[model samples]
Target: MSVLKGKKILLGISGGIAAYKTASLVRLFIKSGAEVKVVMTPASKDFITPLTLSTLSKNPVFSDFYQEEDENPIWNNHVDLALWADLFIIAPATANTLSKMANGNCDNLLLAVYLSAKCPVYFAPAMDLDMYKHPTTIANFHKLQLFGNQMIPAEKGELASGLSGEGRMAEPETILDFLEKDWQDKLPLKGKKILITAGPTYEAIDPVRFIGNHSSGKMGYAIANKAFEWGAQVILISGPTHLQVNYPEIEVHRVTTASEMLESCKDNFESVDIIIAAAAVADYKPKVVSEQKIKKSDLEIDIVLEKTTDILAYMGAHKKKQFLVGFALETENEFQNALQKIEKKNLDLIVLNSLNDTGSGFGTSTNKVTLITKSFEKEERPLQSKEAVAEDILNKIIQNYEV
Candidate 1:
């Protein structure tokens, strides 16, 4: 009983070392009963030839809009291609392809198809440690997250970069797990507009430096991704994170600072059926930033700090019938603080995490959470993958909303 039985998926492959993984990914999709189709970028051919993918998918690989002019006038029409899938999975989404998707740059058939895709869109990025860590790459990631794309967080492993760090593409099995999660018949939050804020927001101190936290956006992005799988119209207003967008029904907006996040939240809050504030926004920022890099001086530099606006409180005051959710990451008195926020922010439910818990908080792949509701009833759960934790949250929401 595979969830993907009869599902039609369009697998988009780009130029990257991890492109080789798609061959097996296609096989997994097919074995699970999905009708898999392949779309390759011109650069993708350099890593894994289209012929190989064609053989695996058992369908013609689409590269250019113009079909070969040998005995057939039929072209690879981007318009028709966009409508041919229940989902689109773009693996090994190189930095260039991500940036193009971010800015809606349609220069080729792949870009055109992506732009025109009315179905769910998924991207898996692969790159070296340095390129993945570059500021531009981080910024592009933020762009995709804000665009409401679903991102499969890269696994940490030895990379082609010769250095050990973050940048590896997710394993094919992991991607398959998330891709088919939405196959259930029940649409609990169907037609509801939910907005999720995720990742770590940056507070600029200088052009070269910013105050940030270790929010992987894992929890929030997982919530956003799962919500879309349930057929909700999700708008993910995210901070800076190395993630890509997903659901065609989900739109994303990116922000970097407390102010930027607040602004984006307010813009979308009115139309939302629910709002989840899972981002780790900076608590303070330099009151006055020096225009240029402050040269080393013998004098002690005192950076006056100011508190950032609390997004949850702001929305709480303006909230209507829409359900509101908040995340509390505490170091001490965790339950007390979470209870206060549930009342203070008028949240229907709040997810509680403590820095004290080993696997639950910070940048870990797993989390232990306590779900607190309006009556202060709590459900303490053991550690699980961020993806599973997200499902737990959504399940609670669905039960509450009776969707």
Candidate 2:
């Protein structure tokens, strides 16, 4: 999932040929799961229709301070609009708009919102090559940066004037990448590598049957996505599950049996800064393998079983500088069992969830958990979405671990 998910973005469009690109930009933001509201300069409507942008953003385009259609005038509150956004972006920022913004000239609703916004502001300048290189434009750019506005520099490309030098608005994908990277730089886990195992391992009994748990991998996948959002390079080793994650920072490895998961973890553990074992791996597998499907007959058949290798224990025994976390699912004495696992596996932290909790446990989107440290420090959390739980877990790790 995108770090941009659920973020409220205020998009400001200024008049320029580049204004046409804002349609694709708004579409990109919406595709990334962000809520978009567009505020265009009056002149910008000449370049791109409000209907097109509104259709893409799913919000009415605001170009004026009041609605003329209503017999009773309804004022558009710029302050309210400014406060509602997590980020404010001005694309196709024309020379006129840039000058007004740098000088605090609130001539339009978009400019008024920029002046009132407390959120981070970004502007992508676009114009003819000569106009872009003008001393006044350069001064405005520097002044805006001084006022805490981020600038997405114009790319070098052919301009509408049939001249190629610079001053072309950045492409939609580039702008999104820029925003994502900027968000990442402010995260606590920036540049850190995280190794996570998720889902339930399947131990094959025969060609037609297998041993598996009810784990949907929702919790683990949530954690991986959260870590990636916090700028961690994540290696998600997953067992058989239906869940899928779409993030550039995560590399997923699929596996079946416990042995496969163990090998993948071991192979990648040395390169990671943190390890989280969230997979509900089977404790044992059938020792004898039947090449064909075991037919269901009147006679009862016995299959010998053997204990699987203890992955967490092995990781703890071979601990270096990496922070190790484990998960414990218990039906009774949850706290004591989790604490014991923390000690036994030499885990830096353990997350405990009870099957008895109504909103928690397997196949649910919500979870109630108790976070326990090796030092026996415990923090209990109420039921929340798995995504929120993942954030809480990462926050706790950030608090306890130095890196």
Q: Best candidate, lDDT-wise?
A: 2
Model 2 misplaced regions, further than 4 Å: 1-8, 14-35, 42-48, 55-58, 71-86, 92-119, 125-147, 153-181, 184-188, 205-207, 247-249, 287-305
Question: TM-score of every model?
Answer: 0.57, 0.76
What lDDT tens digits, residue by residue, belong to model 1 across residues 295-334?
A: 8889997889999988889898898788888899999999
Residues 215-275 of candidate 2: C-alpha lDDT, one tens digit per residue: 9999999999888877799999999998998676589999999999999988997999999
RMSD of candidate 2 to the truth, in angstroms, is 4.6
RMSD of each: 21.0, 4.6
Give lDDT: candidate 2, residue 293: 98
* lDDT score, candidate 1: 0.85
